[model samples]
Target: MDVVATAGHVDHGKSTLVRALTGMEPDRWAEERRRGLTIDLGFAWTTLDGGRTVAMVDVPGHERFVGNMLAGVGSVPAALVVVAADDGWSAQTAEHVAVLDALGVRHALLAVTKADVADPGPVLADAVARLAATSMGRVRGLPVAAPTGRGVPELAAALEELLAGLPAPDRSAPVRIWLDRAFTIRGAGTVVTGTLAAGSVAVGDRLVLGGREVTVRGMHALGEPVERAGATARVALALRGVAVEQVARGDALLTPGAFRATSELDVVLTSGDAGTLPAEPVLHVGSATVATRLRPLDAGAARLRLAAPLPLRVGDRVLLRDPGTRTVLGADVRDVDPPELRRRGSARLRGAELAGRAPGGAAAGAELARRRVVRAADFTAMGWPVPADATAVGPWLLAAGLVDELAARVPQVVTRYRQLRPLEPGPPAEVVRRALELPDVDLVPAVVRPPLALREGRVVAAEAALPPAVQRAVDGVRARLAEAPFAAPDANELAAAGLGPRELAAAVRDGQLLRIADGVHLAPGVEREARARLAALPQPFTLSQARQAWGTSRRVAVPLAEWLDARGVTERLPDTTRRLR
Candidate 1:
C-alpha cells in the first residue's frame, strides 16, 4: 500500500525532508513553521515513477504529539523515517521507532538528512544499529542534504529498492483508512483523508466510519480522481450523511466487515526504557487510545486489557504511552485475541504462535490471508479490539488457541452442564469460557450455534427443575383437570405451595409452566381444541349449554364463559353466551 510515515527526533529536518521530497510543503500550518517543529500532523504529496504516487505523513518528533503520531503512522504500507545525520539518534528517535513498532509500519527508507554538514560514517552506522533493535531494524540508510540535493537520487533509488523487495500488500481485501484530517471544503461536503490500508474505494462507494454508514460522493488520490484506489494509495473522500464532528482522527473509515473491534488483545510487550508500567495505564495503539490494564506475559512482554474496542491487528507494531511519566514504550503486537481476556500475570514468551510472525500488528484475521488468525468480530462482541478480518483458522484466535491447549477441558465442561441440566438449554457462554479459562471466541467453532442463540436474555437452565411441592401442585392441578378442567388452580393456587413467586417466574421463563390466563386451566392441549370448537359454533349458547358441550361444571364453566366474553371470542348480549360468528 502507498501509506508512509516519517520518524526521528524533533527539529531533525523531518518536515524539511518531507517538503523537499513531495514538492508540496507538509508544514502548512503557521504554528508548525513558527515553532520549527511538527506540532501536529503534516501531509505532502509525491509521485512515483510509472504513474504510481504516494502520500506522506510527517509525524511530530516531539514527545507531546505521540498520540498524534500514532494516529498518522498506520494505514500505510511503507514509511520514510527521517533521522538527522548530525544529531544521529536521540530519545525521540527511539520513541518514534517504538511508535512505529506499535503501528507495525515495517517497509521503510531511513533518510539521514543534513549530510552536508556532519560526518556520515558514525551517524549512518548508529541509526541503522538503533533501528535494528526496533521494528525498523532492517531499513537501509540514504544520506541526503537538501542544501545541495546530495544523495537525492540515491535515496530515491534505495526507497524503490526497498519497496520492490517488499511483498505487495493485500489490496484485494476491505478498505480501511484511518483519518489524519477531516474538514469541510467550501463546495464539497465534509472530506476525510488518510492512508488507504487495503482494498479499493470509488466515488459513490458506501463506507462506514466509526460504525456510522456514509456515502462517498467524491474520491481523490494525489489530488486526482480515478475510478478506484487500492492498497498503498493516499485518498481523500467526500462523505454524505455523517456530520464532520462525528468523525475524528482516531476513528477508522472501513468497508463493513473489513475489521472488527475489541478491548482485549494478547500482545507481546517488549521490555525497554518506558520501564514497568502501573497495572492500569493509558494506551495509544494505531489511531485509537484508551486506558488499559497490563498483565505481564513474561519479561519483555504483556497482555493489555483496554477500556474499549480499538481497531488494531496482530503483528502490527504498537507504541505504549505512559502519559503520567511522559515516556513512550515500544513493542511489536505479536497477537490480538478478542472479546478481551483477563490475562493472568506472567512474563510474555515467544512461541510457535508468534514464530515467523511479522513484528507489527495487522490483525492477521484478514479475509483473504489465513495466517495465524481469529475472527475480530467475534472478539468485538466479547469486548475485544475489532480486528480487520476473521478468515484465520480456529487456532489463530486466542480462544481458539486456548481451546487447543485445553483440548478436552471445554467439551468436559459442556458435557457436565448438559448432564446437570439435561432439559435446560445450557450455561451462559461467558460462564463456560470463564470456568475453562479459554478464549471466548474459541467456543465458536466447537458449539452448534452462535453464542447469541444460547444467551437469549433469561437465565437458561439445562434441566427443567421443579421443587417437590411445586411438582405436587402441578400434579394436583392435573388431577383436578379430570374433575373440573376449567377450574384448575390459577397461578395463585400454585403459589400456595412452598414455591415462591421467584420460582414460578423461573418456570415461566423456562417455558415449563404455561399459564393461559387468570382463573383458567384446561387439559394440556385443551385450550386450542376448545377455542377451535367454540369458534365453529353457529350461534351463542348459554353457560349451561356450554358446560354440556365441553363436559364441565359451572365451577369451571362460569369463569371460562366470562373469559371468552371478555376476549370478544364470543358475545354474551342475551341470556345465553355464544362463540362469535
Candidate 2:
C-alpha cells in the first residue's frame, strides 16, 4: 500500500479529485460538505492499475489551515498536486509547492483540475515547470475535470506510475506512526488514525505512547479490519489502556524503545535563508507542530530548541514556519542529540564543525567521535547504524582511541586516589568512573590496563604495595601474631603502632594480615592453624572447648568460630555448639 497527499489551494478541487479517484466522500463534516471546502484532512483510498492500493490524504489548501495541510503531507512520500486551470498559479499553490519541495517529496504528479471550465494545457505546462524547479523535479501533468470524469483515468494511471517509482518502504524499520486523528467510539474506546510510514504493527503489538505502553486492541486498513498492517498504509488503531483525551493529532505511536525523544537538535537548512529566519518559528515534522527557537549558526547550519520534546532522529526533514507570515524553512536534522554550546563562540565553532560533515549522512563512527561514549541502546534508538569498528564496552559504544585514552589516565587517577587515602585499596569501580567522567561504571574494566586490574569490585594496581609507614606497622602486628598465633592485636595496641581501621583494611587487602572481626587482627596463616587445632577436637564441641584448643581468649574465639562457619569450614549447631566440617 502507498499513501499520497493532495497539495494545492482550496477550492482548486483537491478533495474533488480525490473523491473522483476513490469514489468516496472525503469531507467528513457537514459544514465542510456544505461549504465545499476541506477545512481539515480528508481520507480516501483507491486501487490503481496493477492492483496497487493507494491512500490519499486530502489536505486543505487555505492559508488558514496550512498547519492542517502540513500535518497531512508531512509523512506521505508521494503527492498529487492540484491546480485549477482557470486559477492558474495561486499564492497558496506556490506555498504548497514550496512545502512539498522542502519536505523532499520526489514522487509527485500534477493534476490540473477544472479543465472543463478552462483550457488545461497552459496551467498544466505552467504547474509542471514550477514543480520541476522543486524537489519533485520533473513531474507528469494531466488535465483532470472530476465533475465531467475527463482525464481522471489518465491521472490515475500517472499516479500509479509515480507510486511505482517510489522507494520501497522498509517494513522492518522501527514503527513511528504520527497520528492525525484521535477520537473515541461507543464500543471501541480510543481510536487513532495515522499513516504507517515504516515498520509493521500487529493487533497484539505493544507500542509506546507518551512514555507509557499501549496495546493495539484492534486495527483497520482502508476501512477494513486487519490483523496486521505494514508501511505506507493508512491505519486506524483501537488502542487499549488509554483515553481519547490523553491523545492528540501530533502524538506518535512508536515501537517501544526504538526512538529517542529530543527537545533540541542541530539541523542544516535545505531550503530558505537561515539568516532571515525568525527567532521563534513553528516546526512541523510528521503530524507535530511545535514552537521553536532557531539560532542560526552559519549560512546553512542552525540549532533549534523545541518547546516540547519529539521523537526525532538523524535524517528527519522538518519544516520551520513563521506563524505570523507563514514562511516555511526546510531543515534536515543532522544531530538529534547535540552537544551543548557553553563557551563563547561555541555555536559558531559547532557550526563550523557541522559544516564539514554531511547532514543526515553521519555514520556511527562520527557520532561516537563526537560523543566519545554512548549507550548502545541510545545509539540504535537515535537511528545511527552501528558500525563494525565501534568499541562496544558492555552496553556502551566507545569512540576510537577512547579506551586507550581512558586506560592511560586510569593509573594516574589511581595514584592520586592512593595518595589522598594512604591506607586504602585502590578506588572502587564507581570511584574510577566518576574520576574519569565515564558514563557507566561497567566500562571501567574495559579501560583498565595491564598494570591495573579489577579485584573483586575495586580497580586496583596489580601489585598495590601498602604505604611504608602502614606496612611497617602491619609487619610489627604480623610478627607479634606469629609469636602468639591466636593472640591477635587489640585496637588499642594497633592504634599505638599507627595501625588504624584503614591501615588494617589495607593490610587485609594486601593479604599481609587477616581481619577476624572489626578490631581483631591476626597473621594471614593463623586461621589455618586454628582450623587444624579445632578439627582435632571432639565433634560438636562448644565455643569454650575450641577456644581452649586454640589457646585464644573469648574475644578472639567467638569471631573466629563465626568466620569459620561463614567460610563453610565449620557448622554451628542449634545449641551454639560448633563442629569442624
Candidate 3:
C-alpha cells in the first residue's frame, strides 16, 4: 500500500480535496468540522481505477499545528499538495514546503483547489512554479474544483501513476512502526497506529515499545483487519501487555532486539540555509519530535543531542527546525551511534572521517562490517539490511576476515597458554575474546573449529602438550600408583610425589589419574579392577563387605562406592547396601 499525505496553507481545502477524492469524511473530531479547520491528523483512502489503493493522510495546515503536520508526513513517501486557487501561495505554504524539502520528500501531486470560485490557471501556474523551487520540484498539477466536479478524475489518475511508480516495500526487513496515535478501543484494549516503514508484522509476532515487550492481539491495515501487514502500509495494531498511557506518539513498536534507540547523533548537513544550526531545534524524523541541541562540526556536518531515544539509521534525512521560531535546517544522519566528543577539535576530526565515508550501498556496508563485529540489529538500525555476503555467528555479523583471523588465532592462543600453564585447563572464553578484541564473547567458541574444541568451558587446541613440570609430576604419580595398584594415594602422599592439586588435575585430564573423591585418587586401570571385585561380591553388599572384597581401607572404599553410586555403576539399597549396575 502507498501512503500519501497532504501539505499546504490553513483553510486551503486539503481536507476538502481529500473528501472529494475519497468520498469519505477525513476530519474525525467534531470540533474540526464545526470550526471548518483541521486541528490534528485525519485519514482517508480511495481505490484507483485499476484496483490500486492509496492511503491518504490528511494533515492540519495551520501554522500552530506544524509539529502535528510533520508527524503525519514524516514517513509518507509522497504528498498531495493542495493550494486554493483564490488564496494563492501563503506563508504557511513556504514553511510547509521548506519542511518537505528538509525531509527530502521528492514526489508530489499539486491540486489547485476551489477552481470554480477563482481563475485556477494563474494560481495553478504559480503553485507549480513555487513547488519547482522546493525539494518537491517537478510535481504534476491539475486544477480541481473539488466542491464541483472539476478535474477530480485526472487527479486520481495521476495519483495512480504515482503509486504505480513507488518502490516496493522491503517486507523481509525488521519491523519499525513509529507510532503517531495511541488510544484504547471500547472492546479491543490498547491500540496504536503508524506507517510501517519496513518489514512486516503478524498477529502473534513479538514487538517492543519503549523497551517494554508487547504482543500483537490484532492488526488492521488501511482500516481492514489483517493477520499480517507489510511495509509502507498504514497499520493499526492492537497490543497486549502494554497500557495506552505507556504508549504515546513518538514511541515506536519494533521487532525486539533488531533496533536500538539512542539520543546522540552525528549528521552531515545534506542541505540547509544555515551552515550552523540553532543551539536547540525541534528535530523531526520518522514520526518523532525532540528538543535537540546542535553543534556544528565542519562544512556540511554537525552533531545533535536529542531529548529522547530515537531509533535511527545512518544516512537518514532528519529535519532540524528551531522550535521557538520554526525555521528548518536539513540534515542527513551520518552516524546514529556517535562517540563522545571529549576533547577540543574532536567533532571536526570525526566529521572529516564521516564526510569521506560512503553514504549508503554495498561499499559502505562492507566498510562498516570490517571495522568491528556488529550485531545484526546494528546493521538494521543503520538502515542497511544484512548483506548476503556477510558471515553471521548467531546474532553477530562478523567480517569474514575477522572470523578468519580469530580462527587462526584461537589455536595459537590456546597452545601458548597450555605450554606455559599446562596444569590448568584451556583459556577461558573471555580471555580469548578480549585477546582477539571481539565484540561478543559468544563468538569465541564459534571461531574454534574442527581441530579446536571447548573443554570444561575453556577453548583448547586438540593436541596441546602439557608443561614440562606438570608432565614430570604426572609421571611420578603414575610410577607411585603403579607400585601399589590398589592403594589410592592420599593428598599428602600425592604431593610428596610432585602431584599437587594442579598436577593431579592435569594428570586426570590427560587420562593418567581417576579422581574418586577429594583426597582420593586412583590410577586409570584401578577402577575397572575394583568394580570387577565388587561384581564378585554377594548381592546388596554393605560398605564393609565392599571394603573386604576390594582389599582396600575405609578411606578408599567410601568414595569409590559413592562415586560408583553417583555414576549409576552401583545402586544403594533401602538399607544402605550396595548393588552393581
Candidate 4:
C-alpha cells in the first residue's frame, strides 16, 4: 500500500479533503466529529482509477495535537499536504512540513482544498514553490473544492500517478510499527493498532516491547482477521502478555533489539529556532527526545544529553521541537559521538558524511542510526511512540576499527615518549593520560592492565625509547650492578648520567630488569632463585636459614620477604609466625 498523510490546521478541511478523496469519513471517533478536529490519528483509504489503494492518514492540525499529528504522519511514507486555499499557510503548515521532513517523508502531493472559496492560484503557486525547496520537492498541487466536486477525480489521478512512481514499501526488513492506538477488548485482552511499518507479523511470532518478548495471539486488518501483515498495511494485533493498562498510545512494536540505547552522541541541527543556525536542535530519534547541548559553546558541533535511553543509529533523521515553545525546530540524527560523549566543541558533523550514510537508501539512515546509541528521550522529543517498559539502554558500542587503532597506538606512544625523554620512562601515570580518550569504563581494562596503563601518578606509556641521556644512565646502572655483586647505584649517584627515578622505573616496568625493592636491583636469574627458595618455604625462617637455603643476605632476604607477604605468599602471625598460603 502507498500511504499518504493529510496535513493542515484544525478545521481547515483536512478531514474533508480525505473524505472527498476516499469516500469515507476519516473521523472514526464521535468526539472527533463533534469537535471538528482530529484529537487522535484517523485512518482511511481509497482506490485510484486503476484499483491501486492509497492509504490516507488524517493528521491533527492543532498545535496542542502536534504529538497526534506526528503519530499520524510517522506511518505514512508519502503525504498529501492539505492547505485551505482561503487561509493560506498557518503555523501548522510550516510545522507539518518540518515534521514530514524529519520523519523522512520524501514523496508527497499538495491538495489545495476549499478552492471554491477564493482564487487558489496564488496559494497553489506558493505551495508548489515551497514544495520545490524541500526534500519533498516534487510535490504536485491539485486545486480541490472538497465541499463541492471540483477537481476531486483529477486530484485522485494525480495522487495515483505520484504513488506509482514510488518504489514499493520494504516490509522485508526488521519489524517496527509505531502504535497510534492501544486498547483492550474484553475477549482480546490487548489490541494495538499501527501501520505495519516493515516486515510481516505471523502467528505466534514474538512481539518485543520494552525488551520483553510477547507472543502474537492474533492479527486483524480492515476489521477482518488476517494471517499476516506487512509494510504500509494498517494492522491491529492482539498480543499475548500485554495488558491494556501497560500499553499506551505512542508506544512502538518492534522486533527485539531492533534498536539500541545510547547516552551521548554527535548531531547537526538542520532546522533552527528564530533564525539561529541549524547546527543543533534538541533531537528526537526513535521513541525518545534529547536535550542537545552544543559542545564547545554552541559552535555548530553539539552533544545530546538524553532524558531517557533509546535505540538509534547514524543517519536516523529525528524530529526536533522546542520543548518550551512547542514548535518544530529541525531534524537531525546520530553522528560524531558514537558510544562516547565527546568533549564539547571537540568535533563537527559534515553533510557529506551524513549523505554518504543515507545515500537515499531505504534502510541506510536507520542502519546508520542503529550503529549508534540514541537515548529514549531523543525519540520521545521527536514525537516517537516509545514503549513504556522499554528501558534497556546506554553504553553504545564503539566501532572496533577505532578501538583497534587506539590499541595499536598506545604502545607506540609509550615507546616514543620514553625515547624522546630518555631521563624519564614516562610522565606520572596522569601525565600520559592525555594521549587518548576512552568511551566507557569497560574499554579501559581491555586496552591494558586493569583500568588503564598507569605508572607513578600519570596514566601514559612511553611512546618513544629512552633518550640518550636516560639510555646511558640505564646502561650505567646495569654496568655498575654487573661490575659489583649486589651493586645498586642510586638515582642520586646516577644524576650526572641523566636517568631519573622515572626512567629506572620505566625500564623496570618494561621488565628489561628487575627491582627487588627500594634501593635494590637484581638480575632475572637471581630473582628466580630467590622466588623458588621462598616458594618452597612454608614459614618465615631466620636470616641464617635463608642464607643457607638461597645464599643471599638480609639485603635480598628482607625485601624479598616483604614482596612475598604483599602478594599473600606467606602470612605473619602476632607471635612472629610466618606461614605460606
Name the top lDDT candidate: 2
Q: For all the candidates, what are their Cα RMSDs to the real structure?
A: 9.2, 2.8, 3.8, 10.7
Q: Write the per-residue lDDT of candidate 1 for residues 1-581, one digit (tens) a residue.
A: 35567777785888877766667778768988888878788887776653445677888899888777777775556777778878878888877776666555567778889998897778888888877776666778888996677887687666656667666767676676777788998777799888776677888888888778899988888777766787777788899988888877777787765565657766555546224676777776556667888766544556777887776655555667677765566566655552333454213333324334443234333311332334445444222343433334443454324334444454566667757754444566666656755445445445423222444532233344555656666666667766755555555676675445555544455554544554455555555555775655556666676777777667666776676667666677655656563
lDDT of 4 by residue, 412-464 (tens): 66666656765455544333335655434344334443233654444454343
Residues 1-581, candidate 2, lDDT per residue (tens digit)? Answer: 99999989887998888989999999889989999988999999988867989999999999989999999999999998999999999999999988998899888899999999999999989888888999999888999999999999998888888888899999999999999999988888999999999999999999999888999999999989999998979999999989999999999999999999999999988876787778998999999999999899975899999999999988899998888777887888888899888999998888877766763335567778888898889988887877667788788888888888889999988888889986777888999999999977888889998788999888887888998888888888778777889998777898999987777878899888888888778887776898889878889899899989988889998898899899988998999898887
lDDT of each: 0.65, 0.89, 0.82, 0.65
Estimate, for each residue in 1-581, the C-alpha lDDT of model 3 and write its tens digit.
78999888877888888998999998999999999899899999888887888898888899989888989988888888889989998889888888888888888889998888988999888889988987888789999998886899999999999888778878887788889999999878999999987788999988999888999999998779999988788899999999998987888788877766878888876675345457787798877889988887776777888888798877678888886677786788877777778999887787787677756566456555655678776676666656666678898887656677678888788777777776766888888888889877888877888777877777865764567777777777678778766577777877776778777777777666788889888888776777898889888889999888877789998988888888788999899987888
Model 3's C-alpha root-mean-square deviation from the true structure amounts to: 3.8
lDDT of 3 at 431: 80
Instruction: Estimate TM-scores for all models.
Output: 0.60, 0.91, 0.85, 0.60
**Which should have the higher TM-score, number 1 or number 3?**
3
Candidate 4 at residue 273, lDDT? 31
- Assess candidate 1 and give its TM-score to the true structure: 0.60
